[model samples]
Target: MKSKERAIVSLLCATTICVSWRGFRSCSPPQDQRPCACERCLSKDDPCFMKRFNKSVEPFLSANYNLSEDDFNWWKRLQHEKGNFRTFRATVARLFLVIPLSPDVLEPSPDRCRTCAVVGNSVNLRRSHYGPLIDFHDIIIRMNAGVIKGFEADVGTRTTHRVMYPESSVDLDNTTHLVLAPFKILDLEWLTKALTTGFKGRSYAPVMVLNPAFIRYVHHTWLENKGTYPSTGFLALILALHMCDEVSVFGYGADSDGNWSHYWEKIRNKKFKTGGHPGNTEYKLIQELDQQQKLKFYTGF
Candidate 1:
C-alpha cells in the first residue's frame, strides 16, 4: 500500500477502536447487573431529571407494609425520624395479614399526552370560573378535604384522583382514584383498612398508595424537608410531573386579602394562613417552575 493510504487506514482503525471502547463503557451494567444505558440513551447536555429520579427512588418503590421484623424496623425508623406521621403500628398489626404491595397507579404512556390539573383548596379558586377548564384535563387531582360539592361552579366536580392520608380520608366515588400519601405506617394501614375492612367504623372505595420512594423524593429532593414535609398540594404537583405531559396547578397559596381559606369556607381572618407549611417558599418555587415553563401556575383566575 502507498504510505498516504496506509496512514489514512491506520487513523480510521484507531478511531473505530476509540468509539467502540467508549460505547462499551457507556453500556456497562449497574449494581443489579441490569443495563445502565442512561448515558448512551440520554444526551449529556439534555436535562434528564425524570430518568435520574426514577433510578434514585427505585428502592422506595419496593417497600411494603408486611408484618415482619424488617417491616416493623422500617416503621420504627420512620417514626423516630422527625416528620409528620401518626403512629398506628399497634392497631395495624392487629389486622394479622401481610398487606400486599399496591401496583404503580400512575405509569406514563408513550402515545398520549396526559394532561393533569392539581387543584388546591385555596380560596383564590372562588369566582375563578375555572370549573369547566379544570374539568377538561385527563386527570384532576384534588388535595386533602378539597370539596367540590357546592362550589362546583368555581372548582370542577370532575375529580379523577384524590390524595389524602388517614386524617383527611374522604368518601370517593367509584370512578375517582384514591391516592394515599402515607406519612406513616399507620397511614398505609388506614389505607388498607379503609379499602378492605372498615377502619374506625368507616370504609372507603379501593385506594392506591403513593410509592414511598416518590414521597421521599418530594420530601428530600423537592422540599428539602423544609417543614417536616411538603404539603399535600405541593406533593400532588410533583406527582403530576411524572404522570402527565402537561400540568396545570390551581388554587394554591392565599387569596387576594392574604387569607388562606378554602374556597368553600368563609374567611374570618388573615390568621388562616397555611400553618407548619412554608407557604411563601412553596409559592415562590411554583412561580420559578412556571417561569421555566415546566408547568402552568395559575395564582388565581
Candidate 2:
C-alpha cells in the first residue's frame, strides 16, 4: 500500500509538471513561436533605420530649421561622453556602437539624387582646376574655403558640409557640419560656443562627429602608435566609409612629389609651397588606403 501511494504521487506530480509547462508556453511563447504583430511583420519587411532617418532629415528636406527637442537632448548628452565612428578600445570604460552616431540621418537619400565629394585640406591640390569636375558630384564637403568659380562643374555649388576647427578660417552656412577634433577641455568650450550664438551669427547645430571615436578606430587598426591625427583626409575617408555608399576624394595628398599648398591658401597670399599637415607617414598610410579602393582619389591628387 505504501509503494502504491508513492507511485500515485509520482504520477500526479508528472501530470502537474506537464500541465504547468504547457501553461507557461501559452503565457510566454518563443519569438518564433509567438503570434506576430503587424508592426513586427512590417519591421521584418522594412528597415527600421529608414523611417528613423526620414524623421531625422525632415528639417533638412523642408528648409533650414531649428533643432528638435529630441535632437538637442541627444546632442547635449553625447557632447560630453561618447563610436564608427570607432575603428579602437584602449580603456575598459570605452564602449562601441553605444549610440548610432550624429543621429543617423541620411545626408542625401536615394530619391534625393545626391552624389558626394569629400575635399581634403591637402596643399597638393593647389591650382589643380579640378573644382568643376568636383562640383558636378552633388554634395561637396570642402574644408577651409576651398572654392573656385565654374568649379562646381562636377561636385555642385552646394557646400553641404564644412569640417572645421575654431582656429579654422572656413566660412560656414546652413548645410555646414562643423566637425570638432576635441583633444582637451578648451575644445569643448569652443564647440559649445559654435553651437550657440558665439560665432556672431544665427547659431547652427553642428553634426558633432566625435573625433575620439575615429581616434579609437585609428588605434584599433594601428595599435599603440596610431600615428598623429592620422591626417584629416584619412578621417574624411573613414567618414565616407561609414556614412556613404559611394564617395569621391578630392584635394588629397596623392602628392608623392611632396608639394604642399592648397588652392585656397594661394588666393590669400600664402605660400603654395608650404607643406601643411603632419608627418608623411600618414600620407603614405592614406595612399595605401586609397590604393585598396577604400576611396576613389582624384587621378591628379
Candidate 3:
C-alpha cells in the first residue's frame, strides 16, 4: 500500500478511538451506587429530559431583595391585576420581619436521592388507597385544600409542603411548610396580614413564596405560553422536579366518571373546566414525561 494511504487509515483509527473514549467517560456512573431517578435519562442522552429544566431559575423569593421591573410586570399580568410597586415592596419587608427571610434551598446530592410525591386534589383519588404509598416518599407535597381528615385512606395524612394561594388557603400545622403561590401583589399582602394578624385561622408553619421568575419560566418554557398561566397544581409539580431527584405524581387527571371536582367535594358541576389554564395541554405534557420515564405518574382508579 502507498505511504499516503497508510497515513490516512491510521488517522481514521485514531479518531474513532478518541470518540469512543469520550462517550465512555460521559456515560460513566458516579461512585455512589445508590439509584437516582434522574440519572437514567440524563446519562442516556434523552432529548426531552433537560430541554425544559432551567436550573438558573430561583424557586423562592428572599427578603431585602427587589424584583426587576420586567419580572414584576409579567407576574402582575397573570390575572390582569394591578398593584403599586411601592406597596408590594413594603408588604414583603413586613413579611420578612415576622418570618424567615430566606429559607434553605434543597440542592441535589450525589450520595442521597431525594424522593418527592406531588399530590393533587383531583377526584380520581377518592379510593386509590395511595395513602401509604404517598407517605413513603421523603417529601409529600399537597396542594390547594387537600383535606386529610376523613379521606386519610386515599390522600394520605402526612404533608411536608402545602401549596396555596390567598383564596384557596387552608390552615396548616407547625410541621408542614406553607408554600404560597402568589400571582398578584395583593396575595403577598394577604400572606403578610395572615401571618402577622391572622386571616381565617392561625398558622405557625414556615413560609416560602414562589419566585415570579420561576413561574414565568414554567409558563413560557414548559407550557410554551399556552394558557393565561399555569395552574397551582402544575406549578407545584414543576417545583418538585427542581427540589427532588425523584418525583411521583398522584391524583392529577379526571376520574373514571369524567368529573372534574375535588376529591373532598361532591360532583356539583359535571362539565366543570379549569379557568384560564391549559388543563389538557398540561396533562398531556405530564403523560409524555411519564412515557419517557422522566417521572412516575399515578392515574388513580
Candidate 4:
C-alpha cells in the first residue's frame, strides 16, 4: 500500500513537469527564429548595403539619421572586459559625461543633393586634378592624418568630416566633425579624457566617436572579422553609404608603376602596402562596388 502511494506521487510530479515545460515554451519563443525586420535588417536584402549595388546618385532611401538609444546600449553589451582592470560597462558609465551617445544628425535636404567624396591617401591622387571635383561633394570624408595644407590643389581642402584613431587624431574647428573610430576600450577612454581632462597633457579638442554597433557590423558583416580590424579608409566608405546618397571615390589603388604611396608623401624605392590588412581583397571589393555602378571610381593618373 505504501509503494502504491509513492508511485502515485511520482506520476503527479512527472505530469506537473510536462505541463510546466509546455507553459514555458509558450511564454518564451525563440527570437532568432523569427523573420528579419526591414529597418533593422543588415543583410543583403537592404538596398543601402547590398553587395550587388547598381544605382545612380540619389538620396539614401533609408539612412539612419543618427544613432538610436538601442545602438548605445549595444555598445555597452558587446564590449567585453577581457583581462582588464575595469569592466567595459563600468568604463562606459564613467565616460558617458563627455562622449555623445548619438552622433550629430545629417539633416534631410529637399532642395540640394547630398554628395560625398571619400578621398584615400593613394599616390595616384598626385596630379590627378580632382580638387575641383572633390570640393563639389556636399560631404568630404578624410581618414587618419590626411593633410590638406600642402596638397589642397589635388585633394580639396573643404573637409566636412575627418575619421581617425587616437594616434592619428587631429584638431578640428567647430564646423568639421572629428569622427573617432575606436579599436579598443582604451580608445574610447582616450577620447573622453582628451576632450574633458586632456590626454597626454594635450587635448583632442572635443570629438564625436562612431557608433560601436556600426563598427561591429562593418567588422563582422563587411570584413568577415578577418584581420585585426578593417582599415580606416574602408570604414569611411561604409560610413559614406550611410550618410550620402551619391558617393564618389578618388585616389584609390596603386600608381601606374604598381606602387602604393600616399599623395602627400614622397615616392620611395620600396612599394608602400598595407600591413596586417587584406589590401588586395579590399581593392577587389572596391572595384566590384564601382563596376556595379553604385558609385563612380576615378582612377587618378
Candidate 5:
C-alpha cells in the first residue's frame, strides 16, 4: 500500500470514526416492525451499522464542483498517475461545459418505498429467470456490459442506471442514466471526448460522474481499505443503499460451479479472478449485508 493509503487505514483503525450520511434528507420509514431501507437508520443493536453509511460523501458530481486538495490527491492515487490536479480540474471544467451535468439525488419518501435492484454481470444469472422480479423494482441498476437484449428473462430489460467505465460502456437508450465509475483521470477525459464526439451514439442519454470522494469513502469505510479499490459493481451496490428504500442484489459472485463469467458470454477463462478488486472480501460483505436484512441477496444457480 502507498504511504497515503497506509495513513488513511491507520487513521480509520485508530479512531473508528463513522462519517454522517450527507445527500439524503430523510430515510424510509419502517413497515410494521421491519427495518428501514437506509442502514444508517437501522436499530443500534448492531454497532457496526453506524460505520457503514457515510452521508458526508456526495454520490455524484454536479456543475461548478471543486475538489479539495486532500480529495484530489487521494483520488489521483486510485489507479494510475494520469495527470496532475491542474490537468484534472481543466478536464472536468471542459467536460462539464460540453455535457449536461445533473445532481442525481434520490431522496427517501415516507409514503413510497423506492425499491432498487443492483444487477451484476455474473454468469450465475444465466438461468435464474429473475427478469420479472428485477423489473418489479422501482429502480434497476445494471453494471458494465451486462447485456439485456436476449437475456432479458434472466437480467431484466428495465435499467434506471448503468454503472460502467470507458472500456465496459455500452450504448443505451435516452431513458437510462449513464453512471460513470471513473478509475483514473483518463476515464474522465474519455467521457468528455466520448460525449463531445458522440461516441457510441450516447449523446442523448443522461450522464453522471461518480464523486471521487464517494469512491474514497467506499474504499476506506465500506471495504475497510481492502484491495486497490472497490469494484464498480460493489460501488453500484453501495449507491443503491443510499438511493432506494429497499435494495435487492442479483448476478454477483461465481456461479454454482464456481465459475466466473459474464451472463451474456461463455466462460473462456476458467481460471478467471476479480483482477485488482478483493472479490472474496466483497462477496463476504454482501453476504453479511444480506444476513443483516439490509438488502435482499439472490444467489442464482
Candidate 6:
C-alpha cells in the first residue's frame, strides 16, 4: 500500500475505536448499590430524633397491649431499618429501596393528636354503619376523590385533614378542611399556582408532602420488602392504623359479590374504580386487619 493510503486507513481505525467505546459506555446499565442518603425518604430526623422516637414507640406498645418481643422486633426491624428491604431496578445511577413499614406506628400516636381517622371510599360503606364510629375521631384524614356528601352523613362530614393531589376532585375552602398533598414535579406548576395566586392564604391550610420521598421510600421498601408498595389505600389504612387509638375504616373493598365499586360514582356506572390508587391484594389485607379486629370496617362486607 502507498504511505498516504496507510495513514488514512490508520486514521479511520482510530475513529472507529473511539466511537465504539462511547457506544459501550452509553449502553451500560446502572448498578443497584446506593448510599443511605434517604434524600428521597424525607425524615433525616437524625439519630437524636430516632433515639427519641424509638424510646417512645417501644414502651408504648408493651404498656398499651400485648405485643410479643418477636412481633415488636419485627415491626421495628421492618419499619425503621432499611436493612429489612430489598432492592428494585436501578435507573440513572439510582437505587430504589422498599421496606414494609411496621404496624407499630399504631401505638397511640407518639404525639397523640387528640383523635385521627384515615378514611377511604370503598363500596363497603354502601351498607353505612360507620358514621358514628367515624365521628369519634377528632382528626379525620380522607383521601382523593372520596365522596363527602351522599354517602353516610356523619362518617365523612367531620373531616379535619383532607389529603388530595393537585388534580384531586375535592374542593378546598377555608372552612372545608386542611389539604395535604404529596408533591410532584409534574404537579409543580399547579402547586406553584395554588400557593402563589390560586390558594393564596385560602381558608383551608395547605400542607405539602413531596411524592418523590414517599415514592422513593415506598419504592425502596417495595424493592427490599417484596410486593408493590401495599397500595395507596392500604398505605393510608396503615397510616391511620398507626396514628389513631379508636380507629374505624369506612367504605373500603368489595362485598363477597366481588362488586368492587364506589357509592358516589355517576349513577348507573358499573365501570367505576378507585383510580390507580391500589389493587386487590391490598383490599384483602384490609379485610384481614378487620377480621383480626385491629380495625373496625364499616363497609359491612
User: How do the residues 1-301 of candidate 6 rate in per-residue lDDT, one tens digit apiece?
Assistant: 6999999999999999999988875554222221112111112234432321222222111112333434323433322433211211111012111111121222332233334566776666665657777777766777777776766553557766665666663566654443333332334344445544656456444333322333333323322334533344555554454345445676677655565665666335455544544456566655655675556666554
Give the range where candidate 2 is weakest over 10 consecutive residues by summed lDDT. Answer: 84-93
Candidate 1 per-residue C-alpha lDDT over 1-301 given as tens digits, one digit per residue, 9 for 90 to 100: 6999999999999999999989886666343443221122212233534432343343222234533444334434644633322334454444224343444454444434568899999888988888898999988999889988888878888998888877886777668767777666666556555656655554334455565556556766766667655687887888776666678899998877777788888777767677767788788878877776668888774
Cα-based lDDT at residue 256, candidate 4: 76
Off by over 4 Å in 3: 1-25, 32-45, 199-201
* Pairs that clash in candidate 1: none
Candidate 5 residue lDDT tens string, 71-151: 889988877666888888887888788667666656664445678999999988888999999999988999888889999
The TM-score of candidate 4 is 0.69
Pick the lDDT winner.
3
- lDDT, candidate 6, at 94: 23
Where is the poorest 10-residue window by lDDT in model 3? 34-43
Runs in model 4 with CA error above 4 Å?
Answer: 1-86, 108-112, 198-206, 269-271
Q: How accurate is candidate 1 locally (lDDT)?
A: 0.67
TM-score against truth, every candidate:
0.69, 0.54, 0.86, 0.69, 0.83, 0.53
Q: After superposition, how far is residue 79 of candidate 2 from its true place, in Å?
A: 18
| Best prediction by TM-score | 3
Q: How many residue pairs clash in all the candidates, one count each?
A: 0, 21, 0, 0, 3, 15
Question: What TM-score would candidate 5 get against the native?
Answer: 0.83
Model 2 segments beyond 4 Å from truth?
1-104, 107-115, 145-156, 219-226, 254-257, 267-279
Candidates 2 and 4 compared: the better one by lDDT is: 4
How does residue 174 of candidate 1 score in lDDT? 67
Better model by TM-score: candidate 1 vs candidate 5:
5
